[model samples]
Target: MSKATSPVRFKAKLLRPAKPANAAWTFLLVPKAASAKLPSRGQVGVEGTLEGASFSAVLEPDGQGSHWLKVDNKLREAAAVDAGDTVALEVTPSGTMPEPTVPAELRKALAAAPEANAVWADITPAARHDWIAWITSAKREDTRTRRIANACDMLATGKRRVCCFDRSGMYGKGLSAPEAM
Candidate 1:
């Protein structure tokens, strides 16, 4: 739903990756019940309040038919909460597709291929987002690299969308929220 009449509200405990983790990412598991109100079981663009602090984020699918929000360091600081803290969240679908960030490797590949870059520039943000999602959903580095190459190849040939990608994770099991601590 675009600009929901009432925001979906929930409370979830922030969790960190198990010890020995290399990154500083934190997460909040959106309740399955709350996630059902979201527009897609896939990546959803949301504008929300976390512990009363305003923010926007893209919720990622949790692989078991739910979703999770990746709480970055900035939001955690602004919200003044940390791992192990249960906090309130109020969110509504952002009303527009959020632009996906391009990974470095893919950006480099696109830059080196003029035809692909032109096609990439011509595609809609949603199309670009799908390409990014498909590439990043690869669990293995080799698979990611291959997907990037394939994406560029397809783009160079003027393909506007990623073919056969299950953005919602309903058909393919390729995407999932990272393992929680």
Candidate 2:
């Protein structure tokens, strides 16, 4: 049988506490269809504006058929979200492409290259940001090739812009082999 898939959208109210609490809550959003499967951990993404600050979170299932989200500090501080302020949740089947595995040799080369580090440190943060965004955004082979080439050129001069090295270090120590990809 084919797997069932559909976008789920819902409105949720933020519940505040009577006192400042470090704990977060697990509020539920009923799926639009009874047969609609709730997203598993790392299968959900959120985008919204709260108290004039916008943020996004990737929801990860806690394995109990419940979802948990880690909100950025900006959203938490701006909203002053308490036990009862209403928040909205919209979940859709993400069309995200799987990230390609950057070869370990390339990662090690970048890490060990003193020139690369010097160049990377010289670049502005915005340039680094753009480089990272470009590399991670591409899912196609040609795009990946272009990004890698661009990165190589940047790193050859010891200039780290953004994508000069795999900052996440998919090949480095302590990472599970499965998670490396």
Candidate 3:
């Protein structure tokens, strides 16, 4: 894996959701221009600094051809910032794609289906990531259950990639970063 030529730097105001009065996260939007410079429009691993506090994170697609950074309590405390503050951000896509975590439901389904499990084990990390993303992107429980079943069926049939999955959320509005109020 190789590093990007240079880090993409930008500044964005941190914002918190209003509806979920108990929302635990604050986030900042990456400018479209800066986001376009990253390796992928989808979820991308980035190692960078937020207000001089070094960190690594996965930038989530905003479903509008850009990305957003989730700022948790730890990072906020480290950076000494809060919602409504504009912060400096410099990020470069990680040299390697971080392995995406397999959702428990998918894991159980895969384990029960040996054919799909074999195919799942044989696929590349990126392919697996796409499959997992496609499954977890579902907005409803029923949809998610259906996707898992469909995924197993597809995998059992030797399908290596999720068909018509919009990883970047550019064409399909299936994935997006959480909205900030």
Candidate 3 wrongly placed segments (more than 4 Å): 1-4, 18-21
Which has the better lDDT: candidate 2, or candidate 3?
3
Prediction-by-prediction clash tally: 0, 20, 0
CA lDDT of every candidate: 0.87, 0.45, 0.87
lDDT of 2: 0.45
Error of 1 at 154 (Å): 0.9
TM-score of candidate 1 on Cα atoms, chains taken together: 0.92
Question: How do the residues 34-132 of candidate 1 rate in per-residue lDDT, one tens digit apiece?
Answer: 998887887888899999999988898877788988888999999999999999999998866677889999999999999999999998777888899
Candidate 2 residue-wise lDDT, 2-114, digit = tens: 22255444555543332234534323333334113443322344444544455554443323333444444456667676444565554444443223234553455457766
Comparison by TM-score, 1 against 3, better one: 1
Give one digit per residue, the lDDT tens place, for model 3 in 129-153.
Answer: 8898888888899999999999999
lDDT score, residue 21, model 1? 90
Between candidates 1 and 2, the one scoring higher on TM-score is 1
Model 1, residue 142: displacement in angstroms? 2.0
